[model samples]
Target chain A: AQSVTQPDIHITVSEGASLELRCNYSYGATPYLFWYVQSPGQGLQLLLKYFSGDTLVQGIKGFEAEFKRSQSTFNLRKPSVHWSDAAEYFCAVGRGSNYKLTFGKGTLLTVNP
Target chain B: DVKVTQSSRYLVKRTGEKVFLECVQDMDHENMFWYRQDPGLGLRLIYFSYDVKMKEKGDIPEGYSVSREKKERFSLILESASTNQTSMYLCASSSHDRLIPYEQYFGPGTRLTVT
Candidate 1:
C-alpha cells in the first residue's frame, strides 16, 4: 500500500520569504508524487508532479518540488511566497493501473505581511 | 482545458434522507472520482469509475454508492445521510491515456452538511 506523510500540520511564513513543505512517501516501486493546493472554499489545484527523469520538478504558481529517491521524500518549495500563496497544501502518492492516490493530512500555510 | 463541475456549492440535508451528488466533466475524461475532505484528514476516495457504467470501490466506500451512466457524468449516492457524512465532497476527472500519468482536474466542491 502506498502512503504519504506531511510532517507539518500548520506553518506560518513571512510574506516574500522562502517556503518549504515537507512530504515523505512509502511505496515499493518508483513513486509518482504530486503537490496540490486548495483555497479556503475551493477544490484542489495541481501544483506539480514527478513521474520520472529529473529530480526537480516545476509546478504552477512559482512552485517546485525535488524528489529524493534515497530519502523517499518530495518536498515543495517556493523562492518567495506572497499573501495569495497562503493555502492548504497536499502531497500524494499514486499507484495501481487506475492511478489511485493516497494523500497526506495536508499542511496549512499562512503567509504574514 | 479540462473542466469539472459539481452540482452544488453547499447543501443541507436531513439524516436518513437519500443524497445525490452530481458531477460533470467537459473534456470527455474516461475516469471520474469522488472524495470527501475532512478537517485533519486531507482526502479519502469513496468511489471511482473508469468507463461508463463501471464503478470501483475506493479506500472508504462503506456508506456511498456511485453511478456513471455516461462518460461525462458521475453521480455519488448516499443511501442514508448521516451526521458523520457532513464534509466537503469533491469531484475530479482525468484522462486514461497511457502516455500520461493521469493528473486529475477537480471541481469547486460541495460542502455537504447532514443534520
Candidate 2:
C-alpha cells in the first residue's frame, strides 16, 4: 500500500541554523509529493509540491524540497531557521492524478533563540 | 484565497449524543473531505463527496456519516460519540479538474471531545 513516513517526531534547531525534515514514501507509480506546515491551532498551509520535471521545488517562507526518486524521498530544507518557523510539518503523497492524500504523522519543529 | 470554514473550533458532547460537524467552502470545489487527526496518527480520511448528494467512504468511515446537500457545504455526523472518537476534525476542499493537480485547501479544525 502507498504510504508516507516522517521519521522524526520532533526536532529542535537554533535560530539561524540550517534545518532539514525527512520524508519517505512508498508508491508504485511516480507520485505527487507535497509538504505542508501547520502552526499551533491553525490549519495546514502548503509549502511545496513536486509532480514532474525538476526534482528541486521551492515553496513559500524560504522553504524548499527535493524529490529524489531513487531514494524514495522528498526532504524539506531551509537555509536558516526563524522563531516563527517553529511548527508541525507533514509530508503527503498522491498517486497519478488522484486527489486522495496519504500523509505522514508529522515532525514538530522547535526553534530556540 | 480559498476559504474553508468549520462551524466550531471546539466541541464537547456525551458518549451517546449524535453530533454534527459542519464545513463550508467559498471556493466552488467539486470535492470535499472529512478527516480525523490524532496525536500519533496522521490525518485519516473519514468520508468525501464529489458532488452534491454524492458521497464515498474513505479509509476510516465506520461510525461516521456525511451529508452534502449543497455544493459548498459538507457535514460530518457522528452517530454515537465515543471517547475513542475524540479527535481533531479537519475539513478540506479541492477542485476536481484532472488537468490541474488538485491542491486541497483546509479549514481551521474543530477539536471534538466525547466524554
Error of 2 at A37 (Å): 0.6
Docking class of 1: medium
Give the DockQ (C-alpha) for candidate 2. Answer: 0.73
The count of backbone overlaps in candidate 1 is 0
Off by over 4 Å in 1: none
lDDT (Cα, tens digit) per residue for candidate 2, span B1-98: 78999999999999999999999999999999999998878899999898999999998999999999999999999999999999999999988876
Interface RMSD of candidate 1? 1.0
Cα displacement (angstroms), candidate 2, residue B9, comes to 0.5
Two-chain DockQ for model 1: 0.79
Cand. 2 TM to true fold:
0.97
**By summed lDDT, which 10 consecutive residues of candidate 1 chain A come out lowest?**
A93-102
lDDT tens per residue, model 1, A35-103: 999999999999999999999999999999999999999999999999999999999988766757889
Q: Specify the highest-lDDT model's number.
A: 1
Prediction 2 global C-alpha lDDT: 0.93
- True-contact fraction in model 1 equals 0.71
